[model samples]
Target: MPPRIPVSEAQIDRVVAQFYQRVRAHPALGPVFAGHVADWPVHEEKIGRFWRNALLVQRCYDGNPMQVHRAAGDVKAQHFPVWLSIFDAVLAEELPQHLAQAWSALAHRIGRGLSFGLPQTDDADPVPYLG
Candidate 1:
């Protein structure tokens, strides 16, 4: 079993960048993100901080992701699957198998956190991947 992969801010930023590269080209989520993440770099930094803090317990940033996801009403339940899939693809392609699994679990957790309107830190079902 893959011991939990250690995640850092830089890693989170890389993952977010890779994920968005694909997401921006996606028909379902691209336009939506494009409309808002105009300052893509800034958005990346913000999100990097969000994930770093949320997943790794780093005190880097603060933002209610649940509210953001809720506001992203366009980001339906199906989107979570796509997100996880893309995330899995990215990690598996870039990181080792062990790291990939760890990242997948975390990504799925993030999805479930949003799916049920709770942070991934709280209890919830594991997320499944699909990208």
Candidate 2:
């Protein structure tokens, strides 16, 4: 079994809400998200489900984040860093220190995995070997 991540559903929902709020305000990230996300509330709820599944080991979320991002056509590999930065900030703001740190570590690992799947731009360098 996957190790259970210590977090509450409320914390997951709060972090997702705050993170997306920051994302919508971010100049670079906002435009990219705006192009894809039409209804903010629905998107937030789906993300909340994703976090619940990820942290709480629930079977609620049924979406392919990688496929969704890839099909969006504008989700570049470079965007993951900025996205994770925003998420880390939100996690720090909304969660206790220990919880925030733990979640951030997991998030960064997931973000790197997701970023690797994204197509590289001509101007971007090759992704480094992690193994």
Highest-TM-score candidate: 2
lDDT of 2 by residue, 1-131 (tens): 46267888888989998998889999999999999899999999999888888888888999998898888888988898999999998888888999999989989998988889887673555676688
TM-score of each: 0.77, 0.88
For model 2, what is the error of residue 72's alpha carbon versus the real structure, in angstroms, after optimal superposition? 0.6
List candidate 2 segments past 4 Å from native. 1-3, 122-131
The whole-model lDDT of each prediction reads 0.74, 0.87
* Per-candidate clash tally: 1, 0
Residue 88 of candidate 1: its Cα lDDT? 88
- Deviation (Å) of 63 in candidate 1: 0.3
The positional error of residue 27 in candidate 1, measured at the CA in angstroms, is: 1.2
